[model samples]
Target chain A: MMILGPAHASPENIATMRELMGLDHSIPVQFIHYMGQLLKGDLGYSYHAGSPVSQELLRRFPATFELTTFAFVLMVLCSLPLGVVSGYYRNKTPDNVISVFTVMGLSMPTFWFGLLLIYIFFYKLGLAPPPMGRLSPDVAFPPRVTGLLLVDTLLNGDLKAFLSAFHQLILPGVTLAFFNLAIIVRTLKADLIETLEEDYIRTARAMGIGVKKVLLRHAFRNALLPTVTMIGAIYGSLLGGAVLTEVVFSWPGVGMYAVQSIRYLDYAGLQGFIIFYVIIFALITLLVDISYRWIDPRVQLD
Target chain B: MKEVLLEIRNLQTHFKTDEGEARAVNGVDLKVPKGETLGLVGESGCGKSVTALSIMRLVPEPPGRIIGGEIIFDGQDILKLREAEMRRMRGNTLSMIFQEPMTAMNPVYRIGSQMAEVIQLHQKVSKKEAMDRALDMLHKVGIPDPKQRLREYPHQISGGMRQRVLIAMALSSHPKMVIADEPTTALDVTIQAQILDLMNQLKEEMGTSNLLITHDLGVIFEMAQWVAVMYAGKIVEYAAVSDLFSQPLHPYTTGLMNSIPQIDQPVPKDKMLRSIPGMVPSLFDLLEGCTFQDRCNHVFDRCRREEPGLADLGSGHMVRCWLHG
Candidate 1:
């Protein structure tokens, strides 16, 4: 699993590193050489993985993608309404409690939270098994359909497969959710508070409309613009998927894969992950920029 | 003389502060006859705005509260009504035009939408009807190109146009009484005069009674038939405009009249306006006796120790100074 660091580099790696990093050559020449290599679908072989880096990434990608997607859904489900109420009752007891919890969530290390969850939920409560691997070893997996375990299992019509996959995912999903949820709730609460103070909300109240209508129609709609932007900026953090959480739970996601790759000086896999995140982040940021124009008419792109 | 439309009987409003309850509107009584303009004139912090707000029951509670008051309008006590009932009455039977035109309109909404919303809220009108009324109001206010301006934002319009739009919106529902709180304060001199002219014209056409609140005595002379001079949270003098101006009884009122710079008269060597001597008393640390004693140059032994009631002098004139006695 683990190999040596770049201290003892192969002749090929040395040449590539020199060319790419400009440790020994001009930037343009190195960029051209890098582009040529990249264009040929040659991501190079992983020293730790002992296979093509792309193939290794492809194998691990589904697991990380599934984890983050579930986490994102969980985050949204908890944050939006909670944030609204908390903001509506700002500085009140409920808001104060939520603030304290979010602060604790942000301060605690991901590893500690992940382990604590595993200890209580799995070890003590026995509601769930100690999370390890993507699916049960005994149950044979069908061919990947959408690269999502739950979806693929459902597509295969194997109820047993779906349940097994769902069970294993619950802990890791919650662990990942803690940090994202805290960030979203805090961001949304602040945004909603600012929106509540805007004159439109006061105008709505002055109209003698019900408070529910005032909040939903005026306050929340105005608050969502900033929330959308915050979500986009944080999309990159998902790919890196709570590294300590992955290690503690032993969920076979890209986070663990990336960590193992790094241990071995697996430059190919490391570069693959870095480049992958860069492209994904760039694409999401583009989506965020486009979204602002759609939601707020005043937002003009020069 | 017209019939009385609104009557305030012994109104008192207090504000809860760190020290104690600071009475902002102390036992003041006045009346507005139907279809007549009543000017509430005073210096800043004289609680003129508070009195206007109290009439509408829009005074902010906790810090601001109507401790004792009876705002009787349209044969009903508005202060005693439930919030929902008050909401129905407000903007339908009564409406107010706020001071700052710039902040009055919501920034996020188009003018048409906000205006239409107000119409629909009070009247069970269809959306189309609301839109038509909004457009009509816009046109009535003399906004250039009503259709184009309706879709535009508040910031897009000029200050004068914004004030007109506000006036239009306030009058759209044909409320019985309209309170214009320093409507022309935040405009240029030319814009101020234009707005004043427009308001006068609109008031005449609508035949709706207006309680115009302003510190500008010039505007009071032009628009108001009856004037009430407020000093330190109390109505120090009340009379017909001609009577009050010709023989002002309260020292505060006289001080205020002397402060007004006259362009028609020859400029004196000093050419300086005679301002009221001292600053207004802090509402928090209210004195035992007269609130105006510190500022009144004609203060006597009893003037500093005993607060005078608003005593009727003669005819319709009322004064609250020892000099009147």
Candidate 2:
């Protein structure tokens, strides 16, 4: 209300804003009216986009989803192997080296990391495409099949557009993945160390099962339970925390949309964005809870 | 005479802790002949389990190491074999059953899969064939409803049942020797008797040698053909079970024998059960002479100053004390 008060100060708009706020009515009556409109999927208009808030959110949703999914994939690919190596050769030189590198990754600020990656990969080496937007001005974007440019391009069989979008995504996705990768590596290494001490591990070794087989089949699955929980939490935070990365990369995602709404005092867009974020987070949590049963039989899902 | 199946010559296992090096098994020697059970009996921390682990090469390294030893199994020094070679021998040529059956088997795996895994690891057979062999072994161990029991996890079964499954797994590959390290210690008396009976029956049927390690004198009597009494990491007495029972030469062995209350001959109300006098000495300290000198009833100046070596006393009995020397 404090943020919106100044924006609604003009005489003609003040009456309109007062009607929208239900100023003459009691709080309970206004809350029911708001909920009724919300249940009907009416999020009102976005003053900034000059369109309905839900439609604007739909336009930006795929970008954030694509970035987060790509980052999550990168995190798992990097962390799982590093974590297993650190755990399998615990207290050795390789473990020591990985520990130091993960600590550095954890401590380095995300925005700074993003800028550094842009400097090296973009400005210095020119190995990456410029992250001005999701695609270059020359290349024609494919029709919005899935709304995600990368997927839509691939679906349309436009290899050039897909390649351009993929190159644009690499920097932001890697920057978002860095911290989560560090967290997974550290957590998994600790869990693996404890699991390796289990009697079953000794039994596996005593049976003359190869070390690789013991680690992958016997130890990895048991060690993964705690790490899976960590992944869910890290993913949740990434959805909310991608604001800086989105801003730095100039990517048109829900986080950037939220920032623009806040700056322009676009109340409807902000409210809709918060709701969408919470729903995605809740769905991820539900997926993780269901997965726990499959990963470990001892986990009873009530 | 029976052919020797396994021999430990001057086996020494030590653990390096933050405090100092703990000489868990210092200069121990014993042998198990083919088709015979040799009992290595001692109290906890007397390196009975370490000796078994040493034979299997399963000791946790870094903290525990087999410093000096020749574990000759079936005429080959196993300690000299590569880790890959040793692994091939384990669960195939030589296998072990541990003490805590509850925690020994992997909890996550089903009994059938775990048993089948061992068979497939040692034998070149189809998974179906291995499962069939596993079911056969489970039936031989007297588990009820072998097929139904195979599908259950370790936690789903009782402790005694888990131990039976372990024994079944150990014998599935038909290993020539099985090292049972206090296999019945964690079980109740009835279960212990049942497991022992099953082991004895299996040994007779398969003609397999066993190194039975236990602290229970009664178990030694029931299962072991020969007994080796270990005191402070040294084998102080070695003989046939009957001979060792009738004439315990070392004071430690005598203390152990006297400690068992005779059921046929009731003790007087005023008398107490006999126990050894002193605690087992700390392995971290260097003893000048005998490790058991403080606990021996007949400790003398010679015992305090000079360590005694094992002396053959005609027949097959041997003793490691100054009196015998």
- lDDT string for model 2 (B1-325, tens) is 4889998899999999999999999999898999999999999999899898889898988789999978889989999999989989888879888888988877677888988888999999999999999999999999999999989888888889999998899998898999998999999999999999999999999999999999999999999899999988889999999999999999999999889999888886877688898789999995889889989899999988989998889777989999889
Candidate 1 - chain A - TM:
0.87
Chain A, candidate 2, TM-score of: 0.91
DockQ of each two-chain model? 0.33, 0.57
Q: Can you write out model 1's per-residue Cα lDDT over A154-175, one digit (the tens) per residue?
A: 9999999899998888888887
lDDT by residue for model 2 (A1-302), tens: 44347766777777776676566688898778767888998776787778888888888878888888889999999999999999998989999999898888899888899999999999999998887878877899899889889889999999999999998899999998996788999999999989988877877776677779889888898899899999998887666437888999998988898899998888788988888788778887888899998887666788
Off by over 4 Å in 2: A1-8, A23-55, A266-268
* Backbone clash numbers for all candidates listed: 0, 0
Tens digit per residue, CA lDDT, model 1, B231-297? 8788889999999889888888899899888888776778577888888998776787788898888
Clashing pairs in 2: none
Deviating ranges (above 4 Å) for candidate 1: A1-45, A51-62, A126-130, A133-142, A150-169, A190-203, B18-20
